[model samples]
Target chain A: MKFIVEDAGAYLQIKVTEARIDAAIATPFKDKLREIVVKHRKPVHLDMANVTFMDSSGLGAMIAVRKSLPDNLAIVLCAMTPNVERVFRLTRMDRVFDIRPDAIQKEANE
Target chain B: MRLKAVVPPKTQPMFHRVLDADPVVVRATLTDMRHRFARDVCDDTLGRLELVMAELMNNVAEHAPVATSDRLPVIHLCIVRHQAGLACALADDGVSLPDACMLPRSLPPAIADNLPEGGFGWFLVQNLTQALCYYRASSRNYLAFNIPFMEREDENLS
Candidate 1:
């Protein structure tokens, strides 16, 4: 799995360049997110536009990444495809993280 | 005078495949099936089927213990068309769930202090499907369930 990281001024944007995020890439994805969180020490926005599918393992990885961050830090997710967003809603993780329709718009508004 | 009549069953598999239990193969098979079924089934039904299969197949890939020999494991999946919606049946030659760990029917509490890293697979599956059934027989585990075609407004997060 490949993730392209960018500085979005207010928050760091990480776009997942994979069609599926399951057990095959969950561990590595989580590890990379953690590394970015520590290095940037800023709110992170995950752009899941390319992610067409996510399983329980992928959901667990998101939760794990959220837990690994400091109490004050936030991990926001944005631009999730319908299939990926459905997993978040079904698992109720949508309530846990700050999810938005577009990261750039969210940042500009804030 | 006597009369006899026969009616075919309302439910029958529209698509079925048996594939290696590898994660890559599972992903590819599901993607192909989703596209093929997209035109036949409603979007909600297709999404639910994809979610259920992804979790089930991933579970098998991650936890299913390897057999004593070098041969790889395999799983069978079938999607049946029903009068109301769709039905799925999956069978795998992997290790069965422990006797103590029954299928979870409720969502895990969304607590921030003690968020769970895993254990949400069966919960989502149960909520998304109807007539859910799981049983182990002849050294293979079988899971079968039905999903309605109507739109599920409750699934929307907003």
Candidate 2:
């Protein structure tokens, strides 16, 4: 997995690429986000604008990222695909996050 | 990491799980996979392999063209050390390797936006693993990969 960092004023936008995030690779991905949290400590706009599939491993990684925040940072999930969105809804985690319906390609460019 | 302990010390340090290739089991499978890894690999290390395997199994079960048998697909997992990395494999008794070019070229917008919900599984599987290979001999499919290996207690992403 690879991350593209974008400074979006108050929130740092993290564009995720290579899609699937799960157990086999969660450590590095989680560590990168933790690095961001410690270094940036601002509202995070997780531009899922580019990610397609996410299993529980991916969800767990995101939750890990959330837990690593400075306690005041907000995470906004934009452009969640049906499957990925379904995971959040099923896990009742959608309620824990600010999930917005953003177009896949359109939102990423923004 | 030299694991020479021959006895079951007070702490059981490993977890193994097997699940049917049903969609309902995806969440539980992931939860189980994470709990197993949480003791070792931290969130910052790498998290795609587990996701990749789950996606691969889901794709085999849900997307691959169903044969006349319509038998449920099987997924087998085994964890071992390869040098300084963790080696894992997810094998199935369904379809063969797909066109490499047709692999999900880009990470889609979100799971919800994938209108037909068909291609995301392959897209997801290919993206998660560090090294990926598909074997079609012996009338089955074997998918495998590896990730950096680390011991337990150091995995707090926080």
Candidate 3:
């Protein structure tokens, strides 16, 4: 999995470049996220535009990341595909994060 | 009435099919599970698949020695309608229930079955699936499990 961080002024944009997020990939995925926070601690506007699938491990990693962030820092998940959204809804996590499916290109217009 | 030729009941059960034990197989298995057991399964079915798939795939990856590059394990599936429920089977050519798995365990058993310990998978197989059964064939192992399949009659008939 790969992560791209772009400066968004108020909130940092973290884009995940991976097809699947499951047990096989959770280790490195979490490690990298932790590293990103240590270096660039701030509110994250996560863009999961490329993530096709996510499992419990991935969700665990995401929640862990959410809890570890600096206080007052917010995390927003944007561009969740149908499959990813299903997972969030099943776990009732959609209520926990600010989730939206607007495309990355739409970000500029808004 | 002319008697129709008697056919054998399907030994393979209902809608069950065999597929190769590869990473890509998870997609198909999960798809089938979702379609056939829609009510019994919830959105978390994908996570269940992830946990089961990880253990099975790891069994093959950890134990299946390759004298030949093409000798990966085979996974067989069978779906059966139990008394008041439904179940599926996943058979493989990997070693039979890791010997350490069938023994008495010290942990909570269900959640910690996949820890790094050699037999952690046994714990998972036993707990994740509703009813877990194990048997070893000549050169293969079979796991049969059954879980509750919710029904409209559950409330009305009860």
Residue-level lDDT tens digits of model 3 in B79-109 = 6544444566777886556666655443322
DockQ for each candidate?
0.76, 0.08, 0.11
| Model 3 misplaced stretches (Cα beyond 4 Å) | A1-20, A23-110, B1-13, B39-54, B61-63, B67-69, B81-83, B103-125, B150-158
- How well does each candidate superpose onto the true structure, as a TM-score? 0.86, 0.47, 0.54
At residue B152, candidate 2 shows an lDDT of 48
- Interface RMS for model 3: 7.8
DockQ, candidate no. 2:
0.08
Please rank every candidate by DockQ, starting with the best.
1, 3, 2
1 versus 3: better TM-score goes to: 1
Candidate 1 per-residue lDDT, tens place, B20-92, comes to 8878888888888887776667676788888888878877777756656365568899987766777789999
In terms of lDDT, model 1 sits at 0.79
Candidate 2: deviation at residue B29, Å?
2.4
lDDT of 2 by residue, B14-90 (tens): 44556666655654676677667665565533355455556666666564455666666666666543444567776
Q: What is the Å distance of residue B76 in model 2 from its true position?
A: 1.0
TM-score for candidate 2: 0.47
- The TM-scores that each candidate's chain B achieves against the reference are 0.80, 0.64, 0.60
Worst 10 residues of 1 chain A by lDDT: A101-110
Error of 3 at B23 (Å): 1.5
Name the TM-score of candidate 1.
0.86
